[model samples]
Target: MSSTPGLSTTKQFRNLLLSDQLEFICEAHNGLSAKIVQEAGFKGIWASGLSISAQFGVRDNNEASWTQVLETLEFMSDATTIPILLDGDTGYGNFNNMQRLVRKLEQRKIAAVCIEDKLFPKTNSFIKGDAQPMADMHEFCGKIKAGKDAQSDPNFSIIARVESFICGWGLAEALRRAEAYRQAGADGILIHSALAVPDEILAFKQEWGNRCPVVIVPTKYYATPTDVFRQHNFSIVIWANHLLRSSVTAMQKTARTLKEQEHLLSIEDKVAPVSEIFRLQNAAELQEAEDRYLPRGAEDTCAIVLAASRGSELGELTEHQPKTMVKIQGTPILTHIADAYNAVGIKDIVVVRGYKKETVNLPNLTYVDNDEYAETGELASLLKALQSRKGRAQHTIVSYGDVLFNKYIPQSLCQESDDCVIFIDSNWREQSRYSRLGGFAECSIPNSRRAFNAKVYLKQLGNKIPESNTHGVWMGFLKVSPAAATLITTIITELLAQPGNRKATIPQLLQELLKRQQPIRVLYTVGHWLDINNLEDVVQAGEF
Candidate 1:
């Protein structure tokens, strides 16, 4: 549960109900949607029962159990500081159940609950409007009384949802029930109507005289202007279920379009970006907490960028600087790589520089000179970097400096719990920029039964792998766990000692590891990376 420093959530909700000006709340079905509602400036949340049940793919008729609703409430309460008024359908049962629910809701810091005057396993008010019978007024009043008695917090609210109008009961019965509920200790009365106008609600308000604060759900009559509710001095107006409705519309459209087109090119820009999701999930907070609380050894993840080559294929672009230093959209590819690493909390970045090594400069980086870079390959530069670090890194990310990738690639790779994991582009065959020269990987087929734990192993990794046997092209990025780092350091040291392997590349090193029966997992991605291998590649990378 979350709260403001000076005011409790219950008290805040009570204030909203009793305030002179009208207050509004939007409906949310889950934690993420609840937080979004709060972020949208709503002072409170209406945890709509219909929306919650729909989210579970169940009917609004209490097909989802009370415990399930409580669990969802827990998440909604924890995700936001705003008060939540849960639509507790018929209090889940009688007075005993209402009492227990009140206790549990108070424990979870939910501000209030609105239980409609209907039988247990209630149907939605808008559905079969005149057919659903309202619960006995005296019995529901007792339920409200029990809930008020059970609440330990003084300000916890119990709003009685009067469904008399929906049941075709006259305004007189609605007023009578409202007065009885007020006498029975309900904090507010939420008068519901299925009419296309606010006439019934206004008529009830005119006679009831706001004996207790009146709440309104004009969901059926949304065409009515807000000023009408304010004119009648309605305390709260609930825009219930719109968020879930809008989300359903969006998801359906996106799903249908993607299914028809069999691709995301048309729909990608219409939806939220992955980074937006990370932001809403507060992922940076967890990363900050990990940095502060995780063990020093566990946090000791570093990056080794094999950036020694001049990328002569890029023509005059590398005349004065290394290929990794070439500007892409006004930023160096190495800087972009470093930024990607930094985004995932890899601060200990080491760049292996050789050609124009003096020209490569970046803040907060530890440079390792690979003077033999002109004669050696990526494996030799990696060897030099590993030898300099002396295998202290708990996890190491080795990436080609000229490649630019989405931050999610490294973020996803770091989550793998394997000895060694390589990023592979499964859509490699469709890419015109890639050729036989790029490193290809052959991975064991993933188990179809265990979707969550379906691990794909690297059966072979090298440029020499036949295209027919290859699963994907390696993206020149890989992560090594502590044991894998030690094993790699040892293997590279021994291989370099036998000078014949001096110019071995990263794929060659991976192939050697595979030959020794080392288990290397594969993290498959489609294509969110750019490999700047030539002048055309450089132009494409500029747009990346």
Candidate 2:
């Protein structure tokens, strides 16, 4: 554990941070530190919140100066070869400021950033002698939309961090925020450390992971192996602040080593080899993967729903804003979808706008303004959307913008041979506290042979099972094949083409599919599925 009083520029460190092999982050405390980290054989640099907050010499509040953050980001960008993910303290302010902050950061070529639910400079609720209130949920969601709207590259990762669990809020509250952030357009949910590593990992896996991919910092939380995380379907796992941990650990140990060992030479054996470190930094030629398939995605065929913080799920929470404007746990739900899709590779996306559109700014995402949005359902809003694809996905995904769920629905349904597939959860029950307060309820359906064409159990619409099990509407996710999408479009277009004819909702479209005998499949998602529709639910959605 020897150092020139700093992190080493060794091949091993480079390999860990660079090569995109591990999600380990080398944290840069300041602009000067950013350069040191990069030169010290690191691939990516993390701008930390706690460290940076301490620099301000004031308690963390939701009121840090933007100038400090902006300048620091600029400084970090200048010192690194790898991308720097800034810790955007609540986007440095409200919706407008948040937009500007993200744009400025993206312009700097920083690869990623995080927006926590903590009001910028917010004191931790869990930290003894540091209890404070956070930003209102609605305001925070707007901040999330603002950040997403401001980014140019859809791949530029935006992590929505939820701090409720760590800050004195209960578990139910935390889960509710996780659901909201997923719905709000966040690329992922960044849950903070509740305690030491193992307990934190257990919390993450148990709490709404099926809704989205969970990102974690092992240094502060659980110190489990990667394989354990992979088992729970965590798409991206970052061992955040490890470089910081190592740096400090080395200093402490080396000081003791020198004091205990009469000869400095005895302490030298603990150091990692220098030559191995340079190799990881690629001091030689960078090998090109000539045969590796250029990563391709099926973005060409689909509907891009330009989303806004919409509906009543936010209620008074969004009275001054939109539902997408409210914070889930810590981040807005809107940011969850943006990060989740971009991470796994769904780049071409459309976001239909209604409610408050000015609060969000995103590039490569087609925004369709819904003029009659208040009078129409998602199908009507979708009907107003414009597709860039020549033909829709043979498997088109009709995603609900305001409802937060995971991004894995596409992959799960893609492999299915069924002409039509719907991602469904058996938890489709009557409205719970979160949903009822959110103002949206899962649509009910008769659970019988009719829902599924079963030789094991078949019955006509009128012929019901004597003791049937009933499952209500979904958690708001769909993976429609092109044929099914086209059919739904045709069916709706034909119906709506006639004045006074009602457009078919997603459920209606499927009901018709049942009558038409189209083969349909449902992938079970018994995880958290809250229909976020109001302010009460905005804070309550997935407690169930």
Cα lDDT computed for each candidate against the true fold: 0.88, 0.58
List residue ranges in candidate 2 displaced over 4 A.
1-22, 31-43, 53-64, 124-126, 242-544
| Best-performing candidate as measured by TM-score | 1
Q: After superposition, how far is residue 249 of candidate 2 from its true place, in Å?
A: 6.4
Sequence-dependent TM-score of model 2: 0.40
Maximum-lDDT candidate: 1
- Candidate 1 backbone collisions, by pair: none
For candidate 1, give the lDDT of residue 147: 97
Per-residue lDDT tens digits for candidate 1, residues 327-445, read: 88898889999998888777889999999999899889999999988888888899888888883746888988888888888777777678888877877677535632547777886
Model 2, position 301, has a per-residue lDDT of 35
- State the weakest 10-residue window (summed lDDT) of model 1: 445-454
